[model samples]
Each structure stands twice: as C-alpha cells, then as structure tokens.
Target chain A: MSGRPIFTRPARLAAIVPYVWMLLLFLVPFGFVLKISLSQSALSQPPYLPTFAIAMDDAAWRAALGLLSVDSFRLLLTDNLYVLSYLRSLVVALVSTALLLAIGYPIAYGMARLPLRWQPVAMMLVIVPFWTSFLIRIYAWITILQHDGLLNQVLLALRIVAEPVVWLSTDSAMYLGMIYSYLPFMILPLYATLSKMDPALLEAANDLGASPRRAFWSITLPLSLPGVAAGWLLCFIPITGEFVIPDLLAGSESSMIGQTLWLEFFTNKDWPVASAIAIVLLLVLLTPLAIYNRLQRRQLEAR
Target chain B: MRANRLSPFNIICLTLGAAFLYLPIVILVIYSFNASRLVTVWGGWSLRWYQDLFNDSAMLAAAWMSLRVGVASATLATLLGTLAAVALARGEGFRGRGAFSGMLYAPLVMPEVITGLSLLLLFVAVNAERGFWTVTAAHTTLTMCFVAVAVQSRLSALDRGLEEAAMDLGCTPTRAFIAVTLTLIWPAIAAGWMLAFTLSLDDVVIASFATGPGSATLPIRIYSEVRLGVKPQINAVCTLIIALITVLIVTASLVSKLSRARGESAAPL
Candidate 1:
C-alpha cells in the first residue's frame, strides 16, 4: 500500500492512453457526424464539406434546427411505405424475440437444473454457434430456406407441396434468420440467471401445494425478469438495426430502417437525410433502453 | 424427483430447437457436395462447388484480405483493451472512469449502420482514403470495446493478494504484476482476442462502408454474391468457416481446462 501512492510513469501513461484513443477515434467521429449533419451537401465532391464556425451564421443555425421540425417528421411518419416498413420490422423483431424466448427459456432452465457434470457441455452448445462467422450462419439459412433447398426438397418428397414454396425473399425467412443469429444471446444470460436460482425455493413452492405453472409464475418469472429483460434488450436492440438479414432474406423488397439508412448514405450520398433518419431511429431506440435501464436500476436497488 | 424425468414436451422442444439451430448448417454443407449450377436441383453428389470455390480468385482474395484485417485489428484491440482493463482495475481515483467505460461500451450497443455511417462521414470530411487500413481501423475501434469489457470482468474477479505478496517480497510493482497478475488473467486475454478476431471476420455492415474496391472482406463478398443469388459454393465456404471455428473453440477450451487443472494441482494444501 505504501508504494501505491507513488506515481509510476507506466501506470500514468496506461491510465490515460485508452481514453485518449477512444476520444480521438470514437467520440471524434461521432462529433464529426453531427457536424456534417448540419453542413450543406457537396455537389462536386463527396457528400459533405467542412463549414468553419465563421461560415455558420444565425440563419444557418435556424435552418439546421428547422430540419428537425414536425414537417420532416410528418414526411417520414406519413409515408405509407416507411410506416409499413417500420411496422413490419417491429412485428418481425417482436415475433422473433418471442420465438427465441420460448425456445431459449426451456433450454436454459433445463441446463440450469442439470447435474454439474453436464453443465459445461450444455454451455458449450450455447457458445459454439457464436464461434462461426455470423455471415456464414446467414448464408446457411439461404441454403435451408431457398426453393429446391433442403427444407423444400424434404417437403416436396413428402408431398407436402407439389413444388418448393418461395420461402426466401419473404418476411418469415428474415425472421428465421434474425432469430437464428441472436438466439444464443438470449440463452446465455437467461441461463446465467436461471442457474443461479435456488432449487430450495421451487421445492418449497411445490410443498405448499401450488401447481408448477403457478409456482413458475409466482416465483420463477419475477425472479428471472432481470435476465428476461437483458435477453430481450440484447435481441431487440440489434434486431432493430438489422440490415444484413433483411438484405439477404427479403432482398430488395424489404424496407427496414437500416436498409433505408444504408441507401441514404451510400447509394444516395445524402448525409443530411441519412443523419436525420439515424437521429430519429436513435432517439426511438434510446427511449426504450433508457426506460429499461431505469427499471433495472430500481430492481437492483430493491434487491 | 418424479418431475426430474424428461417430459415429452421438453424432449420435443429440445429436439426441435436443436434441429432449428443445426439443420440449416448441415443442409448447407450437404448442398456444397451437389454437382450442379442450379442450387435447387440435385444433379449428382460431387465436390465441384468446393473446386469452384477454391478456383474463384475474387472470393479467395476477399477471404485473404479478411484474414489480414481480422488478425491486425484483433491484435491491436486486445492490446489496447488489456491496457485499459489494467488501468480500470488497478488505478483508483482515475478521472472520469465511468464516462470512459461508457464511451468504450457505447459502440457495443450502437447500431452498426449508425457507426458505419458516422465513420464514413468522418472519413469523407477528412478526405481520408478508404481501403484495408480504414476497415481495420473501424473494426479495431468497435472490437476494442468488447475486448475491454471482457478483460475488465476478468480483472475484477482476480485476487490481488498474490501481487501484494510479490511486492512485499521486494519485487518491483511491474515485476509483481508480470509474475502474478498477468499469469492469472492470460486466459481472459486469449478469449478476448478470439472474440475480437471472430467479430472482425464476421463484420459486413461497417466493412461495406469503409472498404474500397478489391478490398472486400469475406462477409462483404458473400453478401454481394448472395444479392445476385444463392450458390452452393457460398455454402461450401460457410461450412469450412464453421468447421475452422469449431476446431479453434474446442482447442481453446481444452487448453484452458488443462491449465486450470495444472494450477489447482500445483497449489499447496
């Protein structure tokens, strides 16, 4: 403890380095985005031009602020296609999350209840999927879901359908891909929480003559809400901004906000428009996250 | 005790879930053996797609570029992450530690499209050239945060008493850390490195924005190809990647277990 007070040169440098690096690379880029959002789009060159402080007058500031008005919001809001896409994405994310929760919970619960000898094996199964490249997994879904693919072929041989159904380039296929990619995220945390739950509590509940379902609702569900919340947030947040799944599964017809944002930035090269879309999406996503955070804090404090 | 028996519902659910997770991968691998241009049709079982995949120069180049970027970015990220974890764990009274951690973790949750777009905007404004280096930089920036969090957790769980004992025996602080602290936390560092490597290899959204012509990563290449139509060769590539990852993970897990057993056995009772 005596030498701990002395400032070591290496210690001082290590403490400051990560923050400086993060600021320069991460935060500075974030600020640059915000700055570019306000600048006029360049016609001759790239999408953005640097506008010095002297160039930004009161009128310019007002115009920048005006871009955030109800009219722009309304334009985005009332566009039937945009609204439909948002709803479609929401439904897909919600349904996929539900499927993941349903599939993941039983596995987690079973793993948690198993003998210690089998625990590592069960955990390994959950983690092994993550080791493969994510894109490869999505590509695998294409092979399974495509016409004349494995699933369709099996169905056809069984005479379930005379021909292969067009499963790829559909919402259902996109949901399948999204859930497949994110199910592990849902399982791991749920398992962590469930494994930590005391067996005695369940035994006691059983002894009190409550049905298993009743005991589960009364004891297990509330106790595992933290993990549920965590799993949901993990799946939901990433799924909201999912571009690759929609791009691969639903093709050009999919109108996810992420794909829209991508087109704005890369294809259209409209930084301001893209920024506006991103800002809106961020605000919407952050609201639920903030609420969840607050609720989680309160839950922890109660404990 | 009676309830411990495997219920029919539980068995059904488990089987279906496992099939849902693994069948796609199995099918992809199987289709790769089909000798046909049409992905839907079964001409005959052959290794033609594997041959085709190996012969494809563009795909091969993309795979090589992805490997280079993943290795470089993961290495840089792990170093920075380990340093940051050391600071956070050992350095008390550091200014704005919470804020620093928040910024580090922020990108982990932030949408990839937003991150990619913002970084692209930054690059455009600075007139920075986009290519391999730019993609590596972007990946490093994102991967470092994940590595830092992983390392931080390991550091927090570590027992500091060993280092203190080493220092009391007249070793310098740096020597104490080298002897005790690092030895215990090396596995965590390795895990973080593996995670960072996989993430960099898998990344497509951000890579698409930052990568230039002839510098496409594996995911980007697969994505562009899939945009045209699915092919059996892509499935072949996916199967190979999955196999490689499975091998790496099993090796890492076995090594860690062996080291842990050795450590426990070496301990004096």
Candidate 2:
C-alpha cells in the first residue's frame, strides 16, 4: 500500500459534495413534505397554512408547530373513499406482483437456461422495452385495447366474440398494463439470481434421483426466494403508488391511492391532504423498502 | 448433463414472453404510418401522422424542452454520481457513511409522487421558481442514485492495483486517476449518463409535479394529449422516441463491447 491515508482532502470533498446534495435535494424535501402534511389547507398560493419559513423567530416557529394537526390523516382514516383507495392500491399491488411472478419467473428461468453465447442477447431483449418511454408503452396498449383496435379485429375475425370487447378503461386492461410494464422489473432480479445458480447442484439432485420438477421445487425455488422477495417488493411498492396505468387504463369506479393523491393536489388543491396521503404511503412502503435494503445488504455481503 | 440444455418448454416460454412484450410496440409503430385518421383503421401505409407531428409547434417545443433538461440533468448526475461512486468505493469509514449510502439508494425505490411532491414543496419553501432549472435539479437528484449504483458496481469490480501502479510511477493521485482509473470506468460512466438521460426524457409523473407553466416536457405533453384521446400525432412522437432510444442503446452496447475487448487485450502481464 502507498503511504497515504484513506480520507485524503479530495476524497473527503468528493463524499461531502454528493452527501450535501442528496441531503438538500433528496432528504430535506421529505422534511418539507412532513411539515406540509401537518399544516392545514388554505386558499393561498400554495394552498396551505402554517408554511414554515426558515427565517422565522422561535415564537413564530412554535406558533406554526401549534397550527399543525393530524386532521388530514384522520380524514384519510374516517373517509370511505380514501380508505377504499388505500385498500384497493394494496390489493392491486399484491395481485399484480403475484401475476408478474407467475409470468416473469418462467421467462427469467428460460433466459437463464439459454446458451452462453445467446444469453447476453436474451438479456438485451428483456431490457430494451424497459429503457423505452413509459407513457408510450402504455399508449401502445391503449391503441391495441381500443374498441376497434387490433385485439378486437383479431377477436372478431376468429369469432371469439360477437362484438368488440369493452377492453379499455377496465380493471382487466389496467392489470394487463401493470403486468406488461412491470414484467421486466420482476424478470431482471429473478434472472440475476437464477443465472448465478450453479448447475452442479441440479446435477447432484438428479444423481440423487430427484425428478426435474422435484429439483426445481427443493433446490431452485428455495434458492431464488431472495430474488422473489426482491422482485415482489420492487413491483409491489411502485404499483401501490402507480398513477399512470390506473389513470389512463382503469375505469373511474375505484381509484388507487396515487390517483387520490393526484386529485387532492391538482384538482382539489388540498396540499395538506395530499401531503398526508404521501406520508402514509411512504410509511406503508417503508416496511418493504427496509426489507429490500436488508436483502440487498445481505446479497452484497454474500458476494 | 440434461441440466444445461434449453428444454423445449423453456424455449416456448421465452418465445411467448418476447412476443407478449414486443407485439404491442410493433403494432404501435405500424399504425403510426397509417393514412387514416382513425388509429385502428390502416389506410394504405403513409407518413401522414409523421407529417402532422412535424407541424405541431407545441409538441416540437415540448420535445426541445425535454431534450435540454435531459442533457443538462444527465450530465450533472453523471458528474455527481461518479464522485459518489468514488467516495463509496475508495473512501473508508467516513462520517455518516450509512446515511450517505441510504440516501443514495432510497430514491431508487422511492415513489415518484412522493419525490415530486417533496421536491415541489422544497422549491416553494425556498421561493424558487419552478421551471427549467427546478425540473433539471429534480431529475438530477432522482437519477444520480441510479448512476451511483451503476458506477459503484463497476468501481468495485475494478482492479485497484492498476491505479496504485500509476501512483507508484510518481503520478499525482488525480493524474493517476485520470490516466488510469477514469479510462477503465469510462463505459460505466457513459452508461450511467445514458440511463439518466432516458429516465429524464421518459418521466411523466415527476415532471408533471415539478414543472410549472411554459416548461412542459415531452412526456408531460404526450400524457396530456393521450389523456384527451389517442391522437395520431402522439403515435408518431412515440415511434420517434422509441427509435431514438433503440439506436442509442444499441450503439452504446456496441461501443462498450469494443472497449471491453480492448481492455481485455491491453491487460498487463
């Protein structure tokens, strides 16, 4: 090793630069959200009361703190609309995650099983759509799911239905979009885990007389649990707050929490209520996120 | 052993999955050239929508804005992220390292709405105008974490001995890094920048929240137009974006492969 300390002046400066930037731009913003969540809605520019100013005196600070209340959160609990939206978001997240797993696991396993020379190409195919525009991908589905769109035309030609199915603006369309959009997120992690698995273990299982299916369950499935959890959290956490798919594809009957939050901020201009929804949503997702972080740490340590 | 072979069942799964993923996009591209006003009805293939898209000044302006923001933010994110990757990979036992790492990774999974809401609130509190710079700042913050992760992995995998050998030759630390480490990690840095740019261009939710008047990005504009109904112009725009992204990704991959092969051959004995 060179006769140099680890934390040189430039290295310390490098760490401080990103740390301060993240603290101000990333972490401190959450502080504002929390403060705004406690304040009351108003008719002013930002449409909230008790806005905290940094230059305020201690007396003013205490007064602003006094104005803070849990009423917005209380409203979320007591109101059927908000309560149903949260529950709906959770159900959608859970169900979509399961569907993604069902669809993605096999595809990932298939990609993992691809020949070495072709595996990178297969991985590229899976990642291409991921890098494309989210809105455009969703829009593509809209075109295909329209009343007189390709899906309907094919169905009509095949005599699958007498008329075009009411595909758009339904829960089914929404779920289809969810699975399509998030499939890559699920597949990537599963592929990472599955491809890393040693074939020797499977061969040993076979030598021990375990069938392929038995080997998959006893050896493969258990080994990929961390990936399963990671994929589930990746899909579930985002789907719970998904605004675009439900907004564009799902019907107006029942909305997810993300839609509710959007309406509260944009339509109603209820910043406090929107902030409360955000806080609660964050709290709800914190568990899975923490679990994911722990899993990642374990994975990194393992490596 | 049979374990290494690609089973027919697995091959079928891969084929079906690729079809499912790609068919929609393929259909979208085909319909963008449709001559008919109706999206579903394909009058003989024509460039009608693409023509219509070119004349739409609002759409063009939004695309320009998105491009500017994407470039600025991607550049900023890459710089800060490379610094961060360096700090994480090389700096040992710094103060608040845990929090530093947590803050770096949190935004990767943090909900877009929350991030947008918080950033907007931050702008409001600071009395800063929400326009080009605000959107750029928000995109930078959101994307730098991804860049950090990408670069960090590459950094960790790098052989530090090469950097050390350069130092032993009497090169200053910064010079050694520029002459040696930077050349090796260049591909990851490039990948990080591209990822940041693509994400910035594609984001709708965060842009919708953080943007003010006269600063609507392409995704925001497309989203609004799409919500009204399926316009043929939107299809043309989407096709263009998809084509651009495909080219960029392919070119980047090829370049990285070339660099990797060169690096392999140039390895010292």
The C-alpha lDDT values of all candidates are 0.77, 0.89
Q: What is candidate 1's lDDT per residue for B30-53, written digit by digit as tens?
A: 777888888767778988788888
Question: Chain A alone, TM-score for each of the models?
Answer: 0.83, 0.95
Q: What shift in Å separates residue B50 of candidate 1 from its native position after superposition? A: 2.6
The sequence of per-residue lDDT tens digits that candidate 1 reaches over residues A1-303 is 223643243554675877887887787877766665555556756654444445688988666555433333455577776566667667777888998898789877776766677677878877777777778888888877877677888898899999879998898888788888998889988888887888788889999998988988999888988889888887887788788988888756658888888887779787766776666777768865565555433432232
Q: Model 1 reproduces what portion of true contacts?
A: 0.45
Q: Which 10-residue span in candidate 2 chain A carries the lowest summed lDDT?
A: A1-10
Error of 2 at A18 (Å): 1.2
* lDDT by residue (tens digit), candidate 2, A132-238: 98889999999999899889999999999999899999999999999999999999999988988988899899999999999999999999988898889888988
Q: Which residue segments of model 2 deviate by more than 4 Å?
A: A1-12, A54-59, B1-4
- i-RMSD values for every candidate model: 3.8, 2.4
